[model samples]
Target chain A: MVLQAAIEKWSGKIAEVTIGAANAAGVIKVGGQETLPFLFSEGKIPNAPRVAFEVWDVHPEDWPPELAAAWGENLKDPFAWAEACVNKYQAQALCLRLQGAHPDYGNRSAADEAKLAAGLAQKFGLPMIVIGCGDNELDNAMLPAVSEALNGRQCLIGSAAQDNYKTLTAACLADGHSIIAESPIDINIAKQLNILISDMGLPLERIVIDPTTGALGYGLEYAYSIMERARLAALSGDKTVASPFICFVGHEVWKTKEAKVSPEQGVIWEAMTAAALLQAGADILVMRHPAAIEKVKQHIENLMGK
Target chain B: MFIIGELINGMYSNIAAAIKEKDKAAIQKCALEQIKCGADALDINCGPASKQPVVDIQWLVEAVREVTDKTLCLDSSKPQVIESGLKAAGSGSIINSTTADPEKLGLLIPLAKKYNAGLIGLTISAKGIPQNRDQRLELAATIVSACADQDFSTENLYLDPIVMPVNVAQTQMRDILESIREFKIISEPSPKTVVGLSNVSQGTSARNLINRTFLTMAVAFGLDAAILDPLDKDLVDALITAELILNKNIYCDSYLEAYRRK
Candidate 1:
């Protein structure tokens, strides 16, 4: 018997989302694949998955030493750090995490965080991803002001969760910015957050999903599988889960013992985690370490055969 | 699933009594209740019990209009009766349904085009319901080609492969399921698939269990629409979950609520 082709005749395509202000110099567009990633013969993948290097407002105390040394003293200044990421490392876009506002960190005010984000957006002039401190109360408190400061600048504001999305959702909607909805590893919860945010009137085209992946060898397959399943659902025409996914590739990679404890495995561990997600249907990859970012960029270019 | 609520038919005791008495309130109540429970559309049938199915179908359409504007699936063997219901339906209706018989298709296909309503074609004919997948496929291909000849959009053509009760015809049930998958390859733009879902469990003691289970399996095999009881909570839940697992809807914590609301 002849082998049957595995290609699916999908009626739905992933909703295309472009994260960059209308006035920004450039935009990074993701999603909008009519087939599973790299299934060239069956469907259309309009754009390649993008890689954005991360630069924190507060120096990350827990960052792996290899990751820190890769950036050197430029890490002290967020502007210089982001500049190097874009200009020197040829990073496509930039992600600025306002870690300083967390109570345990600098305990900085929301206004100060907003100012820092706005300054970076002005200096970078690229697709800027402005995210919160990863604290529910703090993120809810800080993201609104940051959203207001970058009101028309068109930064992608993060992370509305099930329990606390109202403030951030309202801020993004009022400010004309996009949002990233974060959920636990559960596929259902990931879909729920997207629905909830869209219910508050953010377009599905303006939202991206992050189904919280862990580092390689640490529940990575579970997270990767959820992303794979979600993408399959999107391709099969489920509008509720069809938004592009944005994975915090570096956050999870840096958290691993392989990346932090073992110097030999640091860069490759990040690359492997990211490369695997790219295959599993990630649309936007957010990372640290310029060396790893360079490797992922090369992999993505090769996949797109650019 | 594109669910057309089946509670408005005169075969049901409540609906039969309401149709005989011309009780507009009862008709409207049933329509609203089904819509509230998540029916995508409604099937309006004045079954053989009605002395005047033509007028009764018209009355059912207008009565449903007062309560909700959801699509009405006009059910009758007579084209005139379907036309009566269509005239009163105002807008957005489906002709449910026609056999592969050329004469029936000759009358109903034009009526479907005239009103711009959707068309459902059964895999049975004037001869009778098919005995196997090949027979069913032959009848279905005839309906699809006939619909295409009329310039009707094939996607709007819903093919119903007759589901017999499992108690008497267990083997036929497997053929019925296989035919749903085959119906997709019959034409360029395949006709949308539906079944009168409650038929699978008609004589069985486990009516709801059999209906929900069978409907879920049918959905997996590419059945996109059904004429079933949306008011049955368990049946609707099964349909929603099947669509979810099949990746037809996005998963959410409150996805059931979300699906119903959509």
Candidate 2:
């Protein structure tokens, strides 16, 4: 009560923020809260988990062949590929995905993507997230299958949005899984989705908000500001917007040239890619390269301690 | 909706004297009243009371514990008082708070782990409450980092960004609201965001009316827990109604039932 009274006494006057740490296995602990984001002083924040590497179903022909070479033969099979990502790469969690299911991509069926999600979860022991390409219909159809397949494992379904929250949220509610509520780039819209989900009688703790991200050099700061603003609302007790957040790090990471292109064409950008994400308030980073994962994990780990 | 009773603290002279006299009946009465009225927890603030704050805290905690199984919200500025409260509580308590104080950051953190107690981290630095959102977040960041460093579970800490009065600055509520949202996004899955529901409506006409309005808005900002009087029908009614409007409770059934009883 003294802390609260003093904090309330000093609310707008203080100027320091804290970010928390990850565990040995990389699950970010809830402690070590302090004045700076993720620093170990202002308060207590505990375990910090490692990053979740993004894996796609449907061989990413769009991805450079060099990228495909990293996974070897596992790239061809979603289930095998996810297993390999976890076992070989020491990935803390897997973002087994249905990127190709988008109409513009593979245009796969909900059942098909759901089956992939089921297979991946069954085959991989790692905590996983099932991501769908931004197609409302396909996501609605497929997310439930993913939810049903994972059941009590507490998987995070790809998303629910203003366009298609009803179906996706229902699946998450039914399966005892969590859902990510994404908004294009507005704090108001982000808050609205959270309200919508709460309106549906789902637990706020079970949902993670993704204030949609933009690539670096392409309005990422706006996303950062929005995340910061949203967090402020949560701290102030806005139940709608206070849930934990999720960021599509790989999606934004890959879209940035610094991550996709090499140093010969430009300055060494891989380092920048990892650094940029850490700076952007990313909690669960979904990355691509083994090097980036290790780099980000290490950077995050360093921030966790003295 | 966690209601931490604000009574039995030195902020009120009668409460201070009762504890000094070791008036178990007086302290027990507050604790039981809160629990019977559905208080999830009771906040015992030992403000500027006894010279032996820690001893007083221990006695009050033990006294309250004897009377009710309801959890204690150990509130005190003195680290020793907090430590004594924790020691007295033994287990399952809520640290009234640890602030952005550098030395205090790591202080109550261990107590929380030791007692498995939930905590409240106020967003204020040694310089005191920030005047703006940036300053407030800075303090919040520091508090969250302290928790992270200690390997304290984020969920265990309730980060209160410190809501100031709307009369002094109308945007004060808005600023706190924004900070609550951002704190959650950044803190993510750690530190439950909360607020002192009474602060926002202070000095406003029809205080209860203002409090209810502010509570609804705060809930929209993603409020998970609030510290307020469970006895206030208007405040309680507002929470139930707000929950329904926000779709927290279905079809307003809970709201209607709550209203009927009131």
Candidate 3:
């Protein structure tokens, strides 16, 4: 009951993390930490789970048709679409996916992605996260411009891999942006990338880790274990691993058949898929369905009871 | 590299009493002592001593700001206290935390944004305190991501990996070692990584003695800043020694100069 009580109390408060400049915009800070991840009462949760609405640079061709369908007319304009995610869905942050920059996607050049990102920055005053195509080289090229274009605003720039960190890290340093260093779900790799970034002489506080989440039935367990291990490392005073963790919850959820397909596929599939990922360790989820985000938030709140 | 003296926190009785009585002398004494000893900043925590912590904190922040231009580390869980302190500070200050709680993120990040203040983000989140380096790393990622959401400047954010007592958690040092090592890699362009040097030795005998050694080891592992006693010669020396060994300081000249000044 004590653990239960603690969990309930802790759930009410969301954790905070500040990146980018200590004094600049785009600083993400989680304020209340009532308990350990999911453990309530040990700490306090003062904020609600913040949401980030997703948008893409170009029309997504490979996405599950259902996801593409959700965006409908909004997909044509990144700015309007971003506004919809925030204004309509009450998203606190915006996730601008440079899907077009992908070689296999729309095949847009890095410069094109950067220019689009710049436009989004001009359009939205709220904090935004710019995710690059998975191509390391293109990400390296595109992120720097995005960082510069959003200078002083403190945007989050990503798809920064170990191999391509130098370019992106330099951009962040020059432009005052925070970054997410992603790694395959291996704990060691996650730690290694964190070290690499700092060793390049950047500060540890600016970087967050994306352990690479999987759909509920896909590799959620692995993501859970990776995240759990990373958090443990931070508490034990590993300043490097102590930055914070991020989950691509929406990306994973939308990709899953349960979330993407209709009830004819399986009546319980949608609920089951969303619930499973929430259990696994999703700090900041980027979701497509407003209802799904609400469902996950409610489940999290009910479980936390805070 | 701004080391905010953390002696004013409520966890200490003398400081709490001073804050309660509105004793400027006591507060001034602590402030001057740390500054004279080499602190770049003084963290003023009002504790839970008043019915309205924000008002009391405002008074204290003004009091401390009146004496020094050194930046302040505003430590309080309440946003109002932080806001009051920020308003009263003579210079930009560091938000003691936006912890890893999801809800608090919105409240704390905006303050950092509004005031153009530096921040300290704790690694522990809503889940609870992590027990090992891996979990700490996960929290570190969460902290950075949350900051990213707010658009906080990466250069200004400092991450405080929660440090438990090694006496209770023997592997804490190892955890810190691994976490810092990992944190450095994950943090792009390295955000400031700091720790409360005192936490490692709490409840242990020969605290200062233990603290010095731990501080040295932590600094070696990329600890950029420490919330500690500027007057502690041994601890200060240990940090200098670490800098020299790490070749962080071009020569032992800076170290010698510090020693000579003392």
Candidate 4:
């Protein structure tokens, strides 16, 4: 018998999203696959998956020793740290985590963090993803100011959840920036949040979905499966869950005990987590270890068959 | 859904008058309006009313070609009338039907291959319509096998199980739906499925309701094409909603508009 190819003739496609300005120095595009990722011979895969280095506005107190030592004293200053990542580590993009602005963590006000984001964007001039502290009230307060700070630059700002998407949606619309719509690793919630955000009149092209994932020893399978399903649904033509996926690989990786305490294993743990996410159809990976980012980039290039 | 806009048929008095008068503007308006209302293709039929269906179909095809390059379904049981329309159909033409009757298939199957047009084969024969799923399946397999033997691609063939009026053949409705699902298994690449949707609601008060509801049920069974009134907003809405429920389309607040815009 002549063997036949078991290719899927899918009628739907994941939404291809542009994260940075058309004229930006380092613009990134993802998620225009007609088939599942990296099935190059089966369908069209336009843009390759990418890696985004995560930075922070305030000093990260609980970082793994390996990560802490890698950045050294630059972690204290957001601008210097972001500059070092691009100039040294070849980070395609940077995600500025404003964890310190939470009411519990030093209570730095929204305007102060917005100032830090503005300064970092001007200094680094690379595509930046500014994320809030996951505090609903504080995120509602801070993200609007940051959205205003990077109005013309087409940067990615996030995360609007089920209860708190209106403010972030309004801010992104007013400032002309992309948004990261985060769902708690549930496909339905992920789809619903996208519907809610797009309902506010933000075009689907500027939205990236964060179907929140976990580290390797953690709930990795749950996150992995959700991301995979979202990608499949998108390719199968569900517009509500069709935006490009963005996973915070570094934040989830560094928070794990393996990355923090396992000596030699800690270094490889971050890479393993990121590798799993990339396989799960993550368009952009936010990771900590420089080696992991480099290794994942190489792996991504291979997976894309570039 | 492969909607074949059923407006330009001469069965409609307006279209009949337009066809009789050779009013290209009226026929062109019908074509443009149906295309605007989300018709994937248009069915050109001179109907029983036209004294000269062959001439009318040729003229109607030319009129529609003026406004858009969308696909034309040259709908007729007669091979000569379909052949006349095919001459004027610039491209993207599909032969509307051939019954499993050997004489009809012998005439239309070659036209389908000669024009390289997509074909719809009714699971019907000279002996009359299939009364149940087995009868429909038997006829459908015969049609598929005949197309295969004729070197016509089965993938381009659409099988219509010939929907009967619900008021008369109520029990046959489920069997019709079942045949639509089973027809795919008869070939390697699987022939597509279609229905002359409004036939189910003939002689009924709730024509639109029955048409949309049955159409929805058929969609759940993997219906690929339909020939009905694209102007029926409720019927189109039911189709779009059915596709969304089936996870075939992405949900947007303006999904109704989005589906039409596509």
lDDT of 3 by residue, A139-239 (tens): 77677777777788777778667666888888888987777888888666666677777666667667867778887788788788766655554443344
Q: What order do candidates take by TM-score, descending?
A: 4, 1, 2, 3
True contacts kept of each: 0.70, 0.00, 0.00, 0.05
Chain A TM-score compared with the true chain A, each model in order: 0.96, 0.82, 0.83, 0.96
| Candidate 3 per-residue C-alpha lDDT over B1-262 given as tens digits, one digit per residue, 9 for 90 to 100 | 3466877766578877877777888888889888877687888887776677888788888777778888898888888889889988834788887887878878888888888898888888777888888888888888788888778866788888888887988866788766876777765667788888788888998899888888888877888888998888677777777776785432322333422232
lDDT score, candidate 2, position A86:
72
lDDT of 1 by residue, B1-262 (tens): 8889999999889999998998999999999999989998999999889998888898889889998989999999888999999999965689998999999999988998899899999988879879999999999989988888888888889999999999978999889999999999998777899999888998889999999999999999999899999989999998999988986676667788778865
B-chain TM-scores per prediction = 0.97, 0.91, 0.92, 0.98
**Lowest lDDT 10-mer window, candidate 3 chain B?**
B250-259
DockQ of each: 0.44, 0.04, 0.02, 0.23
Q: Model 2 chain B, poorest ten-residue lDDT window?
A: B253-262
A172-260, model 4: which lDDT tens digit per residue?
Answer: 99998889999888876777777778778997877899989888989999998888877776776566677888999888888777787
Candidate with the larger lDDT of 2 and 3: 3
**Model 3 stretches with alpha carbons more than 4 Å out:** A1-16, A19-28, A31-34, A263-280, A300-306, B1-262
| Candidate of highest lDDT | 1
Q: Return the lDDT, model 1, position B212.
A: 94
Give the distance in Å from residue A91's predicted Cα in candidate 3 to where it truly belongs.
Answer: 1.9
Model 4 DockQ reads 0.23
In the order shown, the candidates' Cα RMSDs to the true structure are: 5.9, 13.8, 17.8, 3.5
Q: Per-residue alpha-carbon lDDT of model 4 for B19-131, expressed as tens digits?
A: 88889999989998998898999999998987777887888898889898999999887789999999899555999889998888888888888888999999998898889
